[model samples]
Target: MSGGTWIAVDGGQSTTRARASWTTEDAAVAGFIQTTDGFAAVAANVSAALAAVPDAPGTIDRLVVGHTGLPIDHASRDRLARMLLADHPVREVVLAPDEVTAHAGALGGPGVVSAVGTGCVTLAVDAEGRGHRIDGWGFLFGDAGSAFSIGRAALEAALRSDDGRNPPSSLVAAVHEVFGGSPRDATWALYQMTDRIDRVARFAPRVIEEAEHDAAAAAIVRHAAEELAHACATAAEALPGIDRVAVTGRLIAPGSRLEREFIDALAARAAHLLTVPSAGSPLDGAARIAADGPSIYRPLVEILTRPESSAA
Candidate 1:
């Protein structure tokens, strides 16, 4: 197993990826190959990712993965673990949620990372290595701060306004503009598909923009940030050693007013807000796990702190 290859599989709600790297006594090559939405679509991309990595040079030993949207129960994690072990000759496999890799990639020392994208999750880790999470619930129950959640909320608000039942939202106007001045067009597009999380989430940025100029939109943004911050605080409390908080996601794009408000709320709570040098991609963190194992959390600090790189 010494001098053997290391493999990593990162399964995300929106995408999945796999990579392999050979190690020496020095640094590793940024040998990331490709990214895929295989796990979400079908098995073909996953098979291709697996074929990309040759068997380990010596005896194949370990495989590590961070899977987003995986069932939180032991039976589910165990089943995925069995699949990895069965598919390859690796001696050991570690199966954990994507939040673990996000924490490893974003938080340094002791801090909380609120990740908001297609979904939202807050992860915290203390110096003692204990971890905590909050608001990782899927779109239906929670995900209050997620892109999908915000977009869904905006749609509901817009529809109510359109129906003359509820007050109008800037979201309606913004969405109307996006769909050629017809909110009905947008509605039809959203309703045309049963699985529209991604399509709806595409409206979040416009919602945020309108929120900056409209009171109703601003209210939604404020409420969303508050919900996200609360989730981060919950994780922080569980990790008493954490004094800093970091926020990441396309929703909180750098220098955006929403991100500014999120930072202000964290400051009000006395949580030092630090910039997490953009969490490049989950696959990068998964590769880190493959090369260094779970205990190598500290070294990940370097990867997360480096200047933002293109998504792997």
Candidate 2:
């Protein structure tokens, strides 16, 4: 079993977070750098992220990561593990798709987890260890009830009002307040930004805030929340008898509008499914997987150790 110094990497599209247990203490770093470039770039990005973390131990017992864009095939996974093993003073490396880690972090058992942040994904696992994923198709294809979708809808509503194609909305004024231009100019500014998704997603809170008193914003938020619930339900449907559901990220925080609406919608659609609070972040899940996770997650997470270390 792995013990002592451990490093957990949460490699995401928008930011990378690395947490490590030091020889004498614990240290963590949240470096706001995009880390997921694909299998070819994962090792370097993971290395860069690990370097950003402060106060690392000279040697590490295990490196656990829930990385975006990690290949699912066994050969690619082994190659990635080898690359990581070569770069760090680690005895073992556990690599998995970020979704698996998120699921483990949230429920840690048979349940459905819907993660709604800049992007969104719903994953479900049953008692038999069968898993199915829903949404997470990225902004262009789907990501149905994600922050990007809500923000884009808010901006579109503002532009629609400007063009008189739809009823006037307070979001038009909000567009000017945020982008300091007409609705059309706001659209142009967004299109010109180097990080369009982050820029757009930043505006989601404004939309959610206005949802309290604005019809247009409320409509968009309600639709997105309902869609999020639907996505979670769809994922849960594949899990057979599992009825537990959990949500993670800023959108689902306690009393947020999105969280409230999502819970209401979920109750309406799947009354038997219970929503539970997440145990921790994906980084925590990586640590759990590294230490050899519960039997339910064994089929989903792979813990790879050096032959010599395992033989010991």
Candidate 3:
């Protein structure tokens, strides 16, 4: 049996994934934990996930962690390292921002990865190991073209239209259609029932669909697409050695105009375009990282290109 195992912990804003793989097998073990409160809660989740794993820490040769909102300072790194070390007695550990792992998961080797969810951001890593980032400003100030941004705009329009402050919007109709008869019910579901920004963001697509029939919603999606494209193109231009760009988001639905535009921008900067329809979960990506060691690029490529399982 191989003496070493590779592990990857990927923490997102809403959840965390932990993966472990033995070097000898193509298979990997993985688990997920949702983040209910915030970073501290996520940290506890990670601790519990690690504890539930069968593998002992000393057997783990290397550990790689990617967490959201980890301050890139010495104290922050030290604290996280301490947390991981508390449970896993690995010889080496590599910690990176969750965005970096998202880039790693999406682009695999070296390229730009634009993650558009509740927020928008682009990160590029050239073959030379250089990195560039753009447009990760918080929701109020920036995050243009993000789901939340689009949803917020659409919601404002819907409310305005309902009160006759603006023209009647199909957006209002779409929202009404999506959430049963009452706009109040939908609003409560979004604001009161869930703290999930991404869930709230889902309503943006309805706005996009309505845009074909409603000018206000259309303008919102168009502006969002434009900004998102700009972010992708900017990152690609700043980084060399990037021939592939991976775009991930609920907004970039297949066959949708948003996907077309995002692809066009990436294609403008890179030679190959791979839209992520089957890229494995971050947990699987993490397993590949754990089993492969230093050659993260090749292992990641294999994981991403591999056919996805049909059964859940």
Candidate 4:
């Protein structure tokens, strides 16, 4: 391997982690860094993430980052590469949508990886490794069954109860406890903040916690499950004959309420499908790509080197 130092990052909406591996003629060293989350397209967030890495190996010989909010197109991905290259000392950079890495990490071959965390993104790769993305559209437009969607829905339910437009919900108390006394005021304040989506998404677990006794919360979780299942079905269809799905992210973690809901929903919609555990986390996928994984993934990422050279 042609390596001085190789760094791989998995940047998500909730967390950012970096791993640096350095090798010399006879010595090797490695270290790790973890930081708060950042939007994938924003340079400042990416820079902050990279800066947190401790090793200074002169220049990072190779860097691969799988991040949220990155567009799939070559121009947009390369644009992000350029921005990161300008800030960090690196010989080559590869940028891709976090789902790409999630898919690679979860299932190295032909299958679908439905990543449901603070955000939701699903990717299906055919036998040839051609990938089709489904429902990673962020909070504003899509991200159907994401934590943001569930939290936002629960907030709306709480607001409805507060407004006397709906029946009393225990979620109203949750709102009061989590967002101060007034639901409307706290929600308005959250909207004013830049991290509104993250703030809203943080409420998902509360809603899930109340699903056992709160009718409104149960309804919200049910709908969220339906949406998540739909995305999984779509991804599975894209994979041709794939009958099982691997999932990543915190939302559908093992033994969680949302995980149970998502599994039931998927069973209802696609009875033939099976829910499979992910082989590895997104970070594992990022490292594989950084090390040049199977050819199927090569076309899905944008790689930028020194000078004007860009590779597909």
The clash count of every prediction, one per candidate, is 0, 0, 2, 0
Which segments of candidate 4 are over 4 A away from where they belong? 1-4, 22-41, 292-294, 307-312
**Candidate 3 per-residue lDDT over residues 1-312, each given as its tens digit:** 123666677665444556666433222222222334434454565665555556653445666766554544666566666556555556556666555666766655677677776667777777755777878675668888888788888877888888889988887777777666455567767776545465556677777777676888877877787787677667877866555566665567667766765666555544454445525434454554555543534322212111123111
Per-residue lDDT of model 4, residues 199-234, tens digit only: 888889899999989999999988888888888898
TM-score per prediction, in order, is 0.77, 0.89, 0.73, 0.87
lDDT of each: 0.64, 0.79, 0.62, 0.77
Ranking by TM-score: 2, 4, 1, 3
Candidate 3 overall lDDT versus native: 0.62
Candidate 1 stretches with Cα past 4 Å from truth are 1-4, 22-61, 89-91, 165-170, 177-181, 271-280, 296-312
Global Cα lDDT for candidate 4: 0.77
Best by TM-score: 2
Which candidate would rank higher by lDDT, 1 or 2?
Answer: 2
Quote the positional error of residue 19 for candidate 4 in Å.
2.1
Please list all clashing residue pairs in model 1, or write none if there are none: none
Clashes of 4: 0
Model 2's C-alpha root-mean-square deviation from the true structure amounts to 2.9
Question: Local error of candidate 2 at 29, Å?
Answer: 7.1
